[model samples]
Target: MPFVLYLLGLAVFAQGMSEFMLSGLIPDIARDLQVSVPAAGALTSAFAVGMVVGAPLMALLSRRWSRRTALLFFLTVFLLVHVAGALTTSYPLLLVTRVVAALANAGFLAVALSTAAALAPPGAKGRAASVLVGGITLACVAGVPGGALLGQLWGWRSAFWAVALLSVPALFAILARVPAGAGDASGTGVRAELRALRAPRAVLTLLLGALVNGATFCAFTYLAPLVTEVAGLGEGWVPGVLALFGAGAFLGSAAGGRLADRGPVGPLLAAGAVLSAGWVLFAVAAPHPVALPVLAFVQGVLSFAVGSALISRVLYEATGAPNLAGASATAAFNVGAALGPWLGGIAIAASLGYRSPPAVSAVLSALALVVAVAAARVGRPGAVVVEPTR
Candidate 1:
């Protein structure tokens, strides 16, 4: 179990590193590719779109396979495509690679979570899911900074190559540790997986993922700008701002997981409250760097807190349709990722202050909280989550 979990973490680390490496490298990419910074940013968008397109397709394709086999295939594409992203020189090709690589990454992550759950001991599935997702938490804790440094010192391509290199070792680890013939996480047949999607509970879980992610993106997409233009800080401070943000993210994620184990709804409520309050703070602090850190820390914690709960909720609800539920969650996150940045960008372009994005984000979080509460009110024994402590 430890070996497989470690491999899953490695895979997630690679994915997280790949997704965020571009954050610090966008300027370099623009300069080298002879495009505007906004254009360079398109690569990030393309990766997200690919996740949307690829998630469901891959999930469907792997219906007949065990979660292990499905994951292995997904990572094969995941590793190679990232290497392709590193090798490409043409801007268009780079965009294509980003899309393909991220699609594979999306599918791979869903499967990793499923596989981890399958491997868990009885009555500790939440811990298992947390272990799978810990990679992203770790990425926030360390991978982003490390990737950014590589991008800063070597080049953006080198950063991608570093991510690709990490994959080689992870792939080898997966091949060595994971046993064959593992069952699906939910023990549902392929046909049952399809049927589970029709369940209202599954649908609600997906909506929660989308709404929460949308709020997360809205507040965070403009973080750099919020800390700079709004606070009148120089670019030199960007690294520190991001680092602090990541630290907050790490703390929040760890705490949230424990909270979810105690009561699923508890963590969700706290996170949504933090999101709303954090955004309000952003609105007030846009002009003050000192205030930004306080908000940023809370922002990071709240932003990342939902994922474990959401993924677990969907998986638990999907019952007969675990794969589909997993894939749907990925799609929902992509939707949020897309919606968040586009809205934030538009707000920025319209001469709205940086606070505008988080303000908008606050509204979305409020909506998510409302939906979560509604789900609780409906209170179907299995439909509304209470999540007892371990």
Candidate 2:
């Protein structure tokens, strides 16, 4: 793998920290802004909504630009948004900043995915994609918790400042290393790209990606409660458990990438099946103190293994529309991210215990497995061919 891939991963880590660190800063933000905690939490939701909308839109708009240009543009915008967010006193302005930051983040991610694949040596695209995914897992492991610590010591604004600073090195590295013409649009026009998405295999693969991610977040979004309330651990154990899960995710990403390079369908089907069963086991063992951490790590491994493979598969299936392929995958994952927590919350509201989230997650994973099996049966593996737009 080229060192530039690692630079792209670094950029992703900074953006991902921004996405998740807000959870730890909600109370501080509410107090500082004189808003309710839920209102403050809306900032996170706003970012998620922006990501879902921005990926495809930005990809379409920037398709004609060189990948390096698009990436630098988005990273600069992201840096500026965080600085603006840090300095803002008005809650509404901060909310606007969050949405704008998310837009930039989404665009950069969409572009980076294709750029990584383009830059890698032939037959190593899956490993390249995993490098990017590893950045997110690393963010979960270190960046988010470090942001929380910064918030605790200084203020929530400090975390924003830190994110902005982190973007500086990524900006310079991308400028220095990423090839100028990498991931340049194929001249297929937006219509041809849109048509590629309509293929039955591509559609099913996208659904599979969403379901796999939804299952992950369904359980993950409520992990703290499972650790403290069900497993009888103290609040202090939450961070360690989350870190353990993240470590597993990082390893899984690397392993999945290598597996995907050989072929995506076989590994995806196998991992998806095990992931579904893992969630069921997780739910059953939630109340056992020793079992909770062990299962959390195992589930994290299985989840990202499936996720990385599905993403690589999506990219392969949409080869005719390279730019849109990455953006669509981004949108699908975010859609799952949003829906999973919502579903888990509903289960909790219905008087199901904290264990219910994992149970819900199990169902979602099974659905993903079903979709994967259907996708495998539908289309021959590899990119769909589309006529060039005249």
Candidate 3:
């Protein structure tokens, strides 16, 4: 394991922390700013909307440049956005900054994933992806807990300030280390790249990720309501349980990486099963205190474990266009991000039978599993950068 990989990991860690920390502190911000909870909470949604908007735009715009330079600019922009967030007093202004930061983050992640793939030593691409993805998992474990504590103590403003400060160390490390420059043109043109991505196998892999992530989030985004409303848990206890769920997620990512290294298909298949099982359990036993943690742990693991394999699958298909493939995956993931909340919200609104969400999610996961299984049958093992044999 080279030190450079660790530096890239730090960049990812810091960026992830910034994005996720907002969720835990929304209440604090809303109260402090004298705004509605949804108004204050719009910051999180703004960030996702930014990612949805920026993922493809930034990837395509930066297509002509070296990934390193493009990624560096993205990181720099995120740093500035954090600074603006820390300094802003107006709610609308703060939302704008979050949007800017998120846009930069979308581009940063796309480049970082590809760079990590290119940088990985022979036969270790999965490990490199793990290191990068681990940052996201670990952010939930660390960032949410730490931010909540800070918001409880000093105030929500203090938390953003902390993120701004951490940005300095992360930016310094990524720029100083991590050889990120791009290379001479490979003769594979953009049109050819797009053509390959439209292949049935490639589209299936993307949709699998999209559906799985959507299903997971359909359950996750409303986890607080699920815990409080369904399980009859107190509001005060919600954060603690969420922390436990984050821990379960970290473990899942670790196990998933190890399993994927052995074979991506097997772990993906297992995760999809786990996802379906978890949702069923959640739908059935959500009211039981013991079952809450049990279901949460399972869903956390399955949701992200399969995500690790999805990255490998996307890269394998888009060998000629690492940036494009990586960006498309990001877009798909965000699309699912948007879809889950919408789907869950609708279920809740319609007075559909109780447990409709997790039940629906189970069906979505089952479909994703089917797609993944079909995909595994066609592709060769490992993250092979398959080029058209001339």
Candidate 4:
């Protein structure tokens, strides 16, 4: 509930914008760089790959640093990368920038989540985590669109310039607002973190987090095709439907925070259940014009609702090393991000139809629910209970 949480959220918003804005800039980048569209698309893939590798590596490297310092270090690197991206003319240089930016982004996010939990009131880590992650959802709603518009009005480089500029306010806020020594982990070395990673319950929770993300992205990555080809909606309607999903995400994050603060298990189980049913319903309703938007919104809501609880659960189980736990969750989530789309693409390639993605998503969601149930049974005999202090 501290104001510093909001400040950290601002930093996250900048990173989120950088991650997604590339989608809207692909054509512009290709034209400007005189590269193939697929080559330009590789930039996005590079960022994602960097995240999966950077999360754990940064946590390991920064195990002895305070969270605030880690955040500042990464954010500064991120800002510089964007500046280089904005100025660079060489296609290879741009690609390198993207990868380095993603590394900084991954480090910042892992530290930020753990820092948010560390700074919150004893019982409100879930709520605090939500507020931190909510910035990413808000970026989906606001930052991406704004970046796209800016790129259209100016150029693709304009978006990078804007993102770099945005980091300034976030830097100032972090320096001025976040107290020193707030997320100190001086004595907690890589050995302690490695030991934490060896715990069975901690590993399960990390995988559960990954599965939860896999379930969401399975359908989401192919949403455009689902809306236009399957639902029979015009291309113009795509933005509106996506906007509805973003709005739902914003609201869902706030609601999830409250629910997660109470306990992690209920929110995890409920979110999984609703998401499973929603994806199944989406598969059936893919052809209905009215139903597509409704289902998209519901999917967005349920997909993100488990985020706070998942982070909180991991932090709890890895009491010896919160940063590593957060980094593991980040890596797991990105793994799911990469895995879900591949699985959905396989289904589509097999002539399973556009509706196949949601069907795949449903199965994944059901599997995630099973994982959540098992995760809930990890620490306690009766039900999952998150004590105030791990």
RMSD of each: 2.7, 4.2, 4.1, 3.5
Candidate 1 segments exceeding 4 Å error = 66-68, 183-191, 264-267, 378-384
Model 1 agreement with the true structure over 231-278: per-residue lDDT tens digits: 888655656666776777667656545544555555467667767777
For model 4, give the RMSD to the true fold.
3.5
Model 2 lDDT per residue over 25-99, tens place: 665788899996446656766786788899999988788888899999999999999999999999999989988
Per model, state how many residue pairs clash.
1, 0, 0, 0
Instruction: Summing lDDT over every window of 10 consecutive residues in candidate 3, give the lowest-scoring window.
Output: 381-390
Error of 3 at 360 (Å): 4.7
Pick the lDDT winner: 2
Candidate 2 positional error at 287, Å:
3.1
Q: Is candidate 1 or candidate 2 better by lDDT?
A: 2
Task: Indicate which candidate wins on TM-score.
Answer: 1
Runs in model 4 lying further than 4 Å from the true structure: 22-45, 84-95, 148-158, 232-235, 264-267, 345-354, 374-385, 388-390
Model 4 lDDT-worst window of ten: 380-389
TM-score of every candidate relative to the true structure: 0.89, 0.88, 0.84, 0.84
lDDT of 3: 0.69
Estimate every model's Cα lDDT from 0 to 1: 0.70, 0.80, 0.69, 0.75
- Judged by lDDT against the true structure, how good is candidate 2? 0.80
